[model samples]
Target chain A: MHSESSPLGEFDLIQRFFKAGADAMRSNDQKMIALGIGDDCALLKPAAGEEIAITSDMLVAGRHFFMNANPELLGRKALAVNLSDLAAMGAKPIGFTLSIALPKVDAAWLEAFSKGLFAIANQYSCPLIGGDTTAGPLTISITAFGSIPSGKAIRRSGAKVGDDIWASGIVGDARLALAALRHEMNLPESDLKQIEHRMHNPTPRVELGMKIREVASAALDISDGLLGDLQHILNQSQVSAEVFLDRLPKSETLQKQSEDIQNQFAASGGDDYEICFTAPIDKRDAIDQISTALNLPLTRIGSVTKTAGVLEKLSLLNKNGVLLDETKSAALLKSFDHFVK
Target chain B: MHSESSPLGEFDLIQRFFKAGADAMRSNDQKMIALGIGDDCALLKPAAGEEIAITSDMLVAGRHFFMNANPELLGRKALAVNLSDLAAMGAKPIGFTLSIALPKVDAAWLEAFSKGLFAIANQYSCPLIGGDTTAGPLTISITAFGSIPSGKAIRRSGAKVGDDIWASGIVGDARLALAALRHEMNLPESDLKQIEHRMHNPTPRVELGMKIREVASAALDISDGLLGDLQHILNQSQVSAEVFLDRLPKSETLQKQSEDIQNQFAASGGDDYEICFTAPIDKRDAIDQISTALNLPLTRIGSVTKTAGVLEKLSLLNKNGVLLDETKSAALLKSFDHFVK
Candidate 1:
């Protein structure tokens, strides 16, 4: 994999691999990118009345992904995860910057990685702008930029009491795939094949997020498990939540698993990339319209409640509508934490 | 140092270290950062007619710094390097995001690191908006955002054949410090103290860059050696350069070194973070006025030349005003390349 006579130097590597990838991935809707990768800094001209939304995510080999993970999938997943953050804020995709550290410059690996990065970037109209390429342990950090109308961004602190908590698409399939990958569970090859896409290439709900901007009271994407991420809303909004397990959405592949597996994974599974949100109960019809218009499921699984203290932030209920004991609920599933891991 | 018990977890770590750092570093002039720290995405609302300039830089532990280096200086230098990129474009300080990968969490180290980061951030009025933290090899990647007038950014492709080449402040001091650290040379304690700050903490020359925008036809920050980085301007502008060896600026400490050492390090040393620019002969008076107003020295070092082909892209001249022979000139200095190193 190491070539002593490689013609590409550091700058040449960026211009050839990254600059060319960005040029090919340029989308017509992304007029905000006034300049791309060739200068000291890229210029972005946001529209007159719009505000820019920015978010960054970093994925390190052996920590965020398997050391033997495919370069193409890793590239796509890195950008996809950051896009999910923008989607949760109801921002329109504009562009993104990628900082990657590679152990070595393997031409074939870079070719596949750039192909995957541009594929998803073009699909979402998020053009590649500027970034840094360095030599180190394999790590990918992407900062995605988007635009939204001023004061219209969905924030975590906007959830009000009695608001309906909603989640987009299904959760837990990605967690299930991870379980299979870890050899913690034995699954049929067909089931693994069915759910692998959720783990490798989960879609960012950009359009759905934009459509529900005026309807959703508060929002955030599920990355560190549904419960843990939702706690961000509870903490910020100073509210409590009671989630009904019977109402939690799941894929048919996930439903085939045992009840214990379904409940646990669906509740605390990370990497869902699905937007968990809340809205006033009266806006249910408007929310349904967005669901039909975008052709994406928007499932209501709980209600926001006024909180007097932090101890009552979350309540978990079983399928029969009975609140589960705190100890049993807490023992069901474990969320991933970087420090702890 | 690794500790058995860490006081902060994932979310609390961000809240205590990063978010609090940003809050303390907030400046009044940086109103463009409408939202910061706690959110799915940070919101930035650029003025109606302004454009955003973005750049990112990454530093690996062993490659960019000593393994036992100070964390505080590392934090400051990480953001300083990105600010230097914006300075090259004559853009105003706005905000930045930091993505860090660490093997373990050390509370005292984090506290000092954040203090250093905020000290420089507040000094430049650049607030911290959003970023990601993950567990991996120690690495810092910072992406800085700045605002510029529409169509007014200094670009490398704008240099003309007769443009005067200029550089701000002194050069070679950082490389001298590096040499001392590598045990390649020994210097007095006073000399080391004078140059150590240049190597570890470089000022971005933000105000000077902004002041000389209209006068400078082309500009860039000297990070990868003066000659190599000037090659970027030459290649982009399709012009050659003739730099006088005697005209290169050096501090009193640097001048105390041997002539060979002085020439080699000043010409090819990296991490200068000083602005190198080209301006028309007619703008000389204006440039001098800017130097006086900003209290920063701007020295003339060379002139751009019309080049017929890439082979003669740069020419080095001695104090006698005669072009040096190619072999002798080429053997004098070497620039750092990560892949090669």
Candidate 2:
């Protein structure tokens, strides 16, 4: 299928590199895949009494990552971000498809990219089922599919007025990493190294999400920022919330920043692939126990209110438990909209 | 959700236009979609005893289409191409997710694009389940999911020796249309107008594909011309085939071209979203009847043979049923690979 006019056909290229990933997954005892690549469509049989959960995320060269970003880490992050979405839904790992546009056929870049992709895929038992590759501006779009019990899938619209808002793991480290990368903040070399992996290779809270499904009323993964993403839960649940600034968890490295820097970046910064959720006050003990069992931090930063609209009137409180000043509150309200750049 | 700095947030943008389309699909009494957008992941429940068939395709500007292509037609083509893959596998349309990277948020372009996208989605009963939209070079990647009876999907690896090869609808018209657009050859304005739709807005042969499932031993969609795509089936089935070039169906406009032009374009040109399949010789009468019932042009273009290891030795015959000359056959083997340019 290779020719001078056509260097390498799409199918041939895929077969040469990506097919091994699909084959590796098939070689495992995965019963869901009836067919993999090398076909018009890959056939998947969902587990009995399960509902498939689907999520897609796109990463562009200049927008999502640097043009010279490591292909290996980029590939891992591309699939990891989508996996984070599935984690927010408490869905078990199933399968995924990748649609990538490359500027050129760099065999070395592709080799490293697929290696990182399949590494994370096999780690989570989510196989690469199918994908399409083309020539264009470098962009990676990954769609991950998972499954949950038929009637037990977690949703964003199930929050109650009295539910306590919680977040999995530390937040703002990825944002801090970005700040160091952009030269917006002068961080020590050791601090930058500490959060670099948090920015490039996020750990999807799949296990924590699945453990909290029994208690959490509403859930979603934080990508844009904690404040902005929490607004989504508030909007979908038709309620308001009060987030305590001092209660927001941060890493030791992030804590080294000034008070104002810590507050703004932790509250409004982007790329925090952690789970933000809400659960009834009565289930707090259970959530805490699960968090301890999983060895991950699940901090309660706020509580849902009976307000009837979205997060329009959501309040941000100071360490003294008083509402923040109007100017600071307004800053927190202005989210990092990706299109706003 | 709307601000001066951000005209429309991603969530708000989706709610404004795309949500209505999702709501329309939900209002149709279809129970497959448990949840649509506005969540971390959309939940889908396939029909009982069905296997979900998944396929993804990416359309890039300047490569797959002209940069100034009509937004509406581009939207339709993006989804239709993926639907064509499901058709090749005899899968019933179910749902799709779109991951679009736009250079900017032009409301009018988005409106027209969504209108065209929903038009075909509704017509085929395939709802828009979920997707991700970001800022980048204009690129549309769609992952379509369909369902077929468990264990009944027509695969490309199923063809046996002595099977009759068939194709639904005319081939090479899309190629002819592309050639005209590229100005490689001269054509009448009427001829250009006649085949332009075939090139831009292709009709996936879903009904014909479903009907032929019982008869087709192997099947695939002709996206990269007849000879090249047929080679996919051959490679997968580990068999060879003899394609009668003269028997390849062509539109009236295409038939007016020279023999060399007709043969080359019909055999190797890409973008024909027609179904090319194979069935046992004994099923000819039944296939013919099914073709008549569906009112699709089902042409018998070749037959399968016992040859192992891909389509390396596949033969192409001329009008008089003789193998094509070496030069012509070599030309027919060169496909439209995007990397070549």
Candidate 3:
């Protein structure tokens, strides 16, 4: 992006704020970046028998985040969501390209954004390679690249009948923070402080994803809530699933909420970057070993089944084994649409 | 993108307007794509001993083009500009990802846009592998991938002293049409129609770029005018160049203008997707032969030189070899910055 008052070109702005951080990330990690930054096009040389996994996401201000949301967290959230896609595919970190359109050039905002971006990029060994900056309403579009061994990528279409469903870490806390921020619900300041990070800065389940490729039959990062996003797996794999309402994992803060609120948010809350996956019933022990080894809470919350005569492919049952009614199910199925009413 | 009145979801919108085109493209071309749309991440497996070239460009409405510009032409131009980057690197287009943000979903607009997008994608055999669409100010950010033999990509940093400078096809017609469109200049409707495609749908010299890689010492796509974009090659190669005003190529429409207007635009027209390249003196015959074989014009316009005694790395000289004055040169050097007035 550019500002008339600022005496810097687009390349100068990138070099001053972002390029240094990218170079710093390179020093600490060796990746498949044959060329980074400052080229007509960056080059990547994948190792033998490796396929590059690519995914892109676009985040617009006021739609994806508050206009006044902290620039640092906004930057981190942008890349984190993309990394989660790579994680869902069971790919190893390689590099990423970011395209940002700013209303104007703000030096302080740029500095903080770069800091957040590089912090996660370094942690995951993904370096910034090539991008474009322009003048427009604030929007961040990132396309991340990762390497996966041939035939090793996990897909949402891989779920099979008689598979155990799993969820990585906790869900619902992010939506809880969002509710308080939107003034739709009230929460103590301390409670908001404890849960806000879940919404603002999500940790990609990349390591867990790569490790489970051998065990998990199907996987997807839960972005648009469990009940809504799991429908994607069901639709693609041509299977049905039943999730036990009482088995969904929750953080300590979310557990304090009312039973209705906990179940509602956990099952249908958007912005939950946790992974929901399915594995063969026989691999439950191996999946548990991976969960213990990584110290991540991988809870068995459901089971995949044949869709024969099932009313709903993704059925959310209550604590007493009663199916959620059509009206409530339809409401929760709305998910997160940018343009739908 | 979506409409409150439209029943389709995001995936449905993409599937209806884009997925079919992508599938059609895949049927005609066999590229490195291991996965196409409907997945968390697309997979590209670069063949052994080859590297991938990646570039991204963002075009914002009212900045890159007129708000009323044809949606079809706009779509074609978006992908064309990105492919030009790959062409500049002497890479062959493999695939691309498109991220679009639309204010609202208009079926007619989307149909025409997809028509233009798939036209070029299929022509170049660069299938649409993955992307994201959302609701926001209309913005299209594209990241293209291309394949190049390892260690063979052309770079702006490769020009050496005494290299011959060349420009592909004509250079100023795009800006000539832009001047008419902006009402900064007057032109007959016939002339406007003739030159409008130069501005709206400039072709990428992918074939010529791939052919001349063996001869070109340095290469870059001229997007922000030849005089302005050439400075990048000079700067990166730490060299100087001289361009003869009489040698600059102009379309018949641009040639019919006043000498001052012709020279001014030919040297400094923006949105020109032509390539400006440098090659060793002996490689002139090789380049000329490739030009003849491809039936494309490759005009020799200048020469690269050492910067030890040259005040300007990129000097524009008149017919008698007189250097242009600083005042005029500075005026032509603005080079289309998005945020600057």
Best by lDDT: 3
* lDDT of model 2 at position A219: 96
DockQ of each: 0.58, 0.77, 0.62
lDDT of 2 at A185: 76
Better of 2 and 3 by DockQ: 2
lDDT of each prediction vs. the true structure?
Answer: 0.87, 0.87, 0.88
lDDT of candidate 3 over A31-150, digit per residue (tens):
588889888899999999999999999999988899998989988999999999999999998999999999998889999998899888988999999999998999999999999999
For DockQ, the strongest prediction is 2
Per-residue CA lDDT of model 1 for B1-341, tens digit only, reads 01222446676778888998888766567779889988999999999899999998888889889878898897789889999999999999899998999888888878888888988898899989999888899988899999999988999899898999999998899999999999899999899998999999999999987888888999999997888788788878988899998888999999999998898888888899999999999999999999898888899999999867553277899999998887767754344566766
Each prediction's fraction of true contacts recovered: 0.79, 0.85, 0.75
Q: Please give the TM-score that candidate 3 achieves against the real structure.
A: 0.97
Candidate 1's docking class is: medium
Q: Which of 2 and 3 is the better model by lDDT? A: 3
List the candidate 3 regions with Cα displacement exceeding 4 Å.
Answer: A1-6, A309-312, B1-6, B309-312
TM-score of each: 0.96, 0.97, 0.97
Model 2: how far residue B36 lies from native, Å: 0.7
lDDT of 1 by residue, A13-51 (tens): 887788998887665667898888878999999998899
For candidate 3, write residues B135-197 as lDDT tens digits. 999999999999999999999899988999999999899999989988998899999999899
